[model samples]
Target: MTSIGIVGSQGRMGVALAAAAAEAGHGHCGVDKDGDVGALAKEANVLVDFSSPAALEQTLDACVAQGRPIVIGTTGLEERHHYLIDDAAADIAVLQTGNTSLGVTLLAHLVREAAARLDPAFDIEIVEMHHRMKVDAPSGTALLLGQAAAEGRGIDLGDCSERGRDGVTGARGHGKIGFASLRGGTVAGDHDVIFAGPEEILTLSHRAENRMIFARGAVRAALWLLHQKPGRYTMPQVLGLGEA
Candidate 1:
């Protein structure tokens, strides 16, 4: 049995991960805000980190020190954090992602493919809705989708994306990807990618009914990371998309 440890045990995702681990017949340790992650790291084969961005660097440092693979689902990471993940991958397996839903991951790929095939004259927009407790706007998932769309067009996301437009926004520009965010109670997660043209509109969406979908994907990623050589990996690798 693979031993597992979860950071941010008190949060919604944490609780769900812990339960999912238990249901999978894996032993799990939960670490809260004041808990000692290093101590737990010593006992687990793999670590799942769903903690805040503020604590991410330190948490990853502890895991790296022990040479333990980790699956990170923390969002709002800066460029420096990406550098750290790349550096850590040189020593231990590290799989970091903004969203852990397998469907969403697949959706990102499809959105990229659609964006590549569709005409540039078609306007692309990504919209996501989540529970109100979420702190980030446009969501990390939405940004991931936008990034896929930008990458499909061979353009930088920062240069072509517009997020959180309000009031009398001017007419949408060509080749510019747009994002919209909505927050409410208990909504698990929902994302839609829309391609609008003068004659037709195409929409692709993924709706999460429960947090378990993400928890399951994270657990799968952690398990896969434990067997991989030290390097950066994503859900596609875990799901065998890399082989395809």
Candidate 2:
């Protein structure tokens, strides 16, 4: 059994990670903010981080120091954070994802395939909803789906993504990827990608009833990381869902 380390031991996802580890028959140690991440890294065979962006630096450093693989499940990361992860990945295996649910991973795959086959007239719009406590808009899963759609359409997501439409906004642009975010009471998570074309509408969706799915997928990813060479990885790679 793997000895897992949790970097955000006090948060909701942290508690879920602990339970998932136990269910997977893995020994686990945890550390919250200002805790000794270095010590936890030393104790664990691998690490799972579901903390804020601010905590990422220390966690990656400690993992690199201890030569331990890490699964980063944190959200709301900026471009700088990815640069940090890429640097650390050169020294130790690292898996980073917006969402770790296996189902979401597959959904991204399908979105890509559909986007590739559908006509450009099929305007793609993505919608996501999460608990009221969630801070980020559009959700990371929505961005992931947007990225997948962009890839299939042979375009850059940053250039094509349309978010936060308000009054006086004109008609939706062709080939633009629209996003809508909803926040309410304790929604685990919900996502839908709609492809609107002439006389037809196609929607692909996924709903998360509980956080355990994320926890379980992350545990599986953590296990997969143990044997990977020092490098960056994605959820699709962990599950062999990437196109060959």
Candidate 3:
């Protein structure tokens, strides 16, 4: 049985992950702010971080110091945080993703495939909804789907992403991937990828009912990380959808 280390133990996802670890017949230890991160890393065989972006560096440092593999389920990360994850990945197994639910991972795969097969006349729009407490707009999962679409279309997401449109926006840019975010009552998560062609609309969606899906998926990812070499990984890889 693996000893799972939980970063942000007090958060919602952390609690769920602890329950998941127990259900999986694995032992777990957790740490929050002001806790002994290094000690936690040393005590556990692998780490799962569902913590805030601000604490990512410290969590990564502890994992690297102990040569532990980590599954990062944290959302709302910036470009700089990615650089930090990349640096740490050079020496340890790191699976970083915006969403961990297996269904969402599959949805992203399908979105990429659809984007590649459809003609440019189809306009792409991604919509996501989360709990009101969620701070990030567009949700990380939406961005993940956008990245897949961009890849299928052979374009850079940063260059073609159209978000936060308000008063007097003239027209959708050619080949733009549009995004819309909705925040409301206690939504676990919901994402829809819509492709509007000449006269038809194709929509792909995934709805998360609770935190357990993410928690269970993270455990699965951590299990995969254990046998992997030091490198960065993704949810798709965890599902064996290599390079899809």
lDDT of 2 by residue, 1-244 (tens): 7899999899999999999999999888899999999999999999999999999998999999999999998999999999999999999999999999999999999999999999999999999999999999889889989999999999999999999999999999988999999999999999999999999999999999999999999999999999999999999997787642
- lDDT, each prediction: 0.88, 0.94, 0.94
Model 3 scores worst on lDDT over the 10 consecutive residues at 235-244
TM-score of each: 0.96, 0.98, 0.98
lDDT of 1 by residue, 18-84 (tens): 9888888888887989899899788889999998888888888888889899999999888999898
Q: Against the hidden true structure, what lDDT does model 2 obtain? A: 0.94
Better of 1 and 2 by TM-score: 2
Q: Judge candidate 2 at residue 61 and give its lDDT.
A: 92
Misplaced by over 4 Å in model 1 are none
For model 1 the local lDDT of residue 83 reads 90
